[model samples]
Target: MANKTLVPQAKAGLNKFKMEAAKEVGVNLTDGYNGDLTSRQNGSVGGQMVKKMVEQYENNL
Candidate 1:
């Protein structure tokens, strides 16, 4: 049997914060398995979360 090592398909596609945000929103983003999420969709989910967080933070300031 051949050994198969799992790896992230796109290392530079998303950052730690984005990954965490995806988890918060219930996205199944594993280290070696992101499933079928497109680049744009993944980016949007993270970006939108950041935008919302920033707005909320600014409102409190």
Candidate 2:
């Protein structure tokens, strides 16, 4: 059996949270070949981004 990998795509809306997180962690996500990123790397950027966004939303409430 072979493993399949999922690729990220730009849809109608942007994943603002992920983009912000990547910026915070100094990951350059400006291009389309982000699939080269390992799962861990990708997850870290995404996770941090979501965390920051949530914190901001909470502070505003």
Candidate 3:
């Protein structure tokens, strides 16, 4: 799959946000490949990210 972002400059910002979410969820997520992690753990991180994004958006409404 291609990890293409429309705003290339926002890639770093997105990564930073992902890292923050991982930390909040107690996920020892590292930079680069994380194939060592279990699917459940990875899914939790992604879910947490989306939850946070939605909260932020709602708050700004």
Candidate 4:
């Protein structure tokens, strides 16, 4: 299957979550577009978001 989000309706929420994750990880993020950011900076933000999500899931379990 083509890669796509399961919950397309949650795109806005996910964007908000991403911004929060970026802030928490000290990555400067802005709305609209962010193509100026370096790959490492973007990767760290994603990594931090995944780490936080996993922690939250484990805590709930």
Model 4 regions more than 4 Å off? 1-3
Lowest-lDDT window of 10 residues in candidate 2? 4-13
lDDT by residue (tens digit), candidate 4, 1-61: 9968789998899989999999998988999789999999999999989999999999999
Candidate 2, residues 1-61: lDDT per residue as tens digits? 6643244464313456566678888777764678777788787897896787689899999
By how many angstroms RMSD does model 3 differ from the true structure? Answer: 1.0
Top candidate when judged by TM-score against the true structure: 3
TM-scores for the candidates: 0.45, 0.58, 0.91, 0.85
- What digit string (tens of lDDT, one per residue) describes model 1 on residues 1-61? 7643355664454456567777776676766767588887687777767786899899999
Backbone clashes, candidate 3: 0
TM-score computed on alpha carbons, candidate 2: 0.58
**lDDT (0-100) at residue 24 of candidate 1?**
71
State each model's CA lDDT, in order. 0.70, 0.71, 0.94, 0.93
Number of backbone-clashing residue pairs for each candidate, in the order shown = 0, 0, 0, 0
* Model 1 pairs whose backbones collide: none
Give, for candidate 1, the lowest lDDT window spanning 10 residues.
Answer: 3-12
- What number of backbone clashes does candidate 4 have, counting pairs of residues 3 or more apart or in separate chains? 0
lDDT of model 2, residue 4: 36
